[model samples]
Target: MRMVQKPSSVVLASLKPSTYTNRTPRAGTLPAHRLAGVSKPDAPYSSRRAPRCGLVGRTFSPFTIVLLVILGGVVATAAQEDERATVEPTLARRAATLILARCAVCHTTDLIVQQRLPEDRWTATVEKMVHWGADLTKDEAAVLLQYLTARYHPGAPDHLPSIENELAMTEPLRGQTTATDGPLTGLAARGAGLYAHNCQACHGEGAVGGVGPKLARNTILKNDGVFWETVLHGRGPMPAWGSVLSHQDIADIHAWLATR
Candidate 1:
């Protein structure tokens, strides 16, 4: 039987740790720049990761807060304005009650407000209303006359009032107004203003015939009944002033025209 022979001493020594020190490695080592490209920390840096796709919009919260505040203010103001308009008072109901109960039996509030009389004239007017069957006491009569004259004649109220009450009050008691009872007095003084308004355009400035015949110069005035008839009938384009004018106002105007 033959046995295997041992390896050479040189070959056995080549397997030792440092025997192949001169040999070149088969793979090349990478530079620091190439290794750094792939390397990362445990977490990404805020500056380097495409800014984390910033979908967390930072301005959204402040804008939403301001918008809500503006809407709230508008709604509150509208509610206040609605409350005021819905509750405002009307005058016709309040003043009409007082006028109808206190003064309507003999004279209307219309008759009282229309006459621009002074306080003294209104005192006389209250006395006349009393004579004409107005059921007013001395105190009620004074307050009413004061209110009438103060409301109509010139001057603001002594104290500012916080309310408005309408009255259709105009003219003195229609049945008893005369030259003295009305605001102005006398025929010539009264008729000039009246004729300027009513008759001057048609009958000339002072009743000289124009569109209508001369009222003063005509033969009608010589007969009182005829004059009265002509005035009431309104013979031409002239209107019937007899019904509209107070009796004394008619007589004063007639007396004034006679001189013209």
Candidate 2:
């Protein structure tokens, strides 16, 4: 029979589960089982190894953590861009409507559409108009300002459906007046342009009438109060211009139409 040596007290003490559980093994030190020349049983998985499926037990390098953060930011920015694209067109349409309904009342659309101004200048212009009696709520003014800056910025293309073309088409008809009539001057001249822009569309060239009733020789022009009331408050099918045209603007238009 082969003789076996008794295990030392130190080796037996180190073999206890409490020894391994209570303290980490020193570097270069072997487990008690390895030192004793006994093989450890194979575990299904090692607790020291990183988990394959989840973030648990994982240790990322500094570079990897930074890269993950960058990716998350990229995703968030892309989502915001998509949302802005969806909302921009609707806001643009609303802005266009406000411009037509409000700005076009006093001056022709061409006056507003022709200029390419920067944001600060546009803001100043809009504010000036408000100060001068434009009827716009704070919200409406803000929306209009945003639209003007975006669509009429210095870098933007010129507005289309050319004002020059419209002017050319109406100029000849506008120039023709009765042999007894004198040349237009002052507020009357200004009103000619306003009438052409605002009234000619429905009232026909020189307010001769088409969709709207004839105003060329309409007796309504004889009474200032009736004319102001009808134009500002609207008639049967006409929309009110009270919120758009200032008193001075309506007066100028009246001065010009009286000639027609």
Candidate 3:
């Protein structure tokens, strides 16, 4: 075979720049790098291998650790709030429905929420509303009272400490004559049984003293309004019974307490 001769340097220099530029890269081959008019050999590219098991040589960064800890604490606190805010029972739910439909007509939900009245006061307030044309049936009224007294009673455990301390500090002096000593008859005489059923446990058998202070000769009885308001709205440790007792029942009890 005849050998081909290499081109002389002079002939090679005479070639146009396009001659080299027109050359195509071979299949599966990368182009060479050029810097400062010098050609550089193409280097073989080796990709980084993935770590064994994806974390054999890895370590958690400080920021990542802190982020994880914060997420955990937030999850824990949210769980606690969920547990504390469980739904009301069936009777309570029915009462809420009635209250929303009837009470919301003339009053705001917040107004009802803000009041921590007793069963007695709740009863009185409801009776007054009925008298004012609230149009609630007797059964509906009873359910509403159950819900109100159970949920917003002044004697709620949350208020117990503060109320107890206040009442204890404000006890009246011994031997002070009360307006309850005034002549009271008829309705009061009939109220004796009612008082025994409703008031005796906390107020004592003769209203002398028990969990509550002595109702006998107490200053609260001097004014009818004050006495009724105290029983309806509650004072210090005493819970309001306005929801539980009828206006007539409260009046009767008031009369009975006067006799006591």
Candidate 4:
């Protein structure tokens, strides 16, 4: 029982290595499972995935780059058109100041914009208005006339007939007393357009007075001289048009008002 039992030589030899090789893994080498293309239990293939293919760290194809360029171009062009569409504040302010001070008293901007008169006509019109009690001084009139002539010259295809020319042409008709007696219907019809342009703002769309007294049933209609005087020289808040309107224009407007 005290004697030690020696292992058999075959058993001892079987336990010993033939070449005594030390197999410590080298640094920067994958684990056995990973080297064999097998996922490790602790670190899975799905969790330690290859770098994903996406916009990040990825090169764009030529077609993709072209699409991006075209989209950018479209955005830039739209931005430029938006800029052009807007009106300049300075220009708008200048026009508004002049128009409101001198022209807006008698009529809306619509009336002024609708007429595309020549330089001479615009000058004459502005001068006439000043004479008839417009608040403008000579310098202001010049500025306003310049603006009007520049923005609304008669060179435009849609420019309206000159007031002077229209009046000069209608003078013969005004002299004919029989023109009024034969049938006021025709005269009233023509006067409708003129009334809408000139008198509608104050006398109203139907001559029922907004800023001015009602003209529909006014007794002043019976007296031609008083009616003409009231219109040409203005009454109270009414602006005078003695220089602006011709006798024929006034007569026609009166005829239209009489109908109303």
Judged by lDDT, which candidate is best? 2
TM-score of structure candidate 3: 0.33
The clash count for each model shown is: 6, 0, 15, 0
Predictions: Cα RMSD each: 45.8, 31.4, 34.0, 38.9
Q: Distance (Å) between predicted and true CA of 126, model 4? A: 14
Per-residue lDDT tens digits of candidate 2, residues 1-260?
A: 11122212112211222211121122255345433444345556645422432255558743344344345435433433332232244444445555555565466566777776667789899999989867667777876776565445443333334322432332233322122133323387778877775677678898899878898879988986677677765666564554345555566788888888
The lDDT per prediction is: 0.44, 0.55, 0.51, 0.52
Candidate 1 vs candidate 3: the TM-score winner is 3
In model 4, what lDDT does residue 117 have? Answer: 61
Model 4, runs deviating above 4 Å? 1-186
Tens digit of per-residue lDDT, candidate 4, span 1-260: 01122212112121112111112122355344433444334436544343331235558743344444445445433433332122232333333455643575676455776775656788788888888877665555655665565445432324433333322333333343212343333367767887776667667878888877788878998987677677665666665555445566667777877887
Candidates in order, TM-scores: namely: 0.29, 0.33, 0.33, 0.34
Better of 1 and 4 by TM-score: 4
> Could you give me the TM-score of model 4 versus the true structure?
0.34
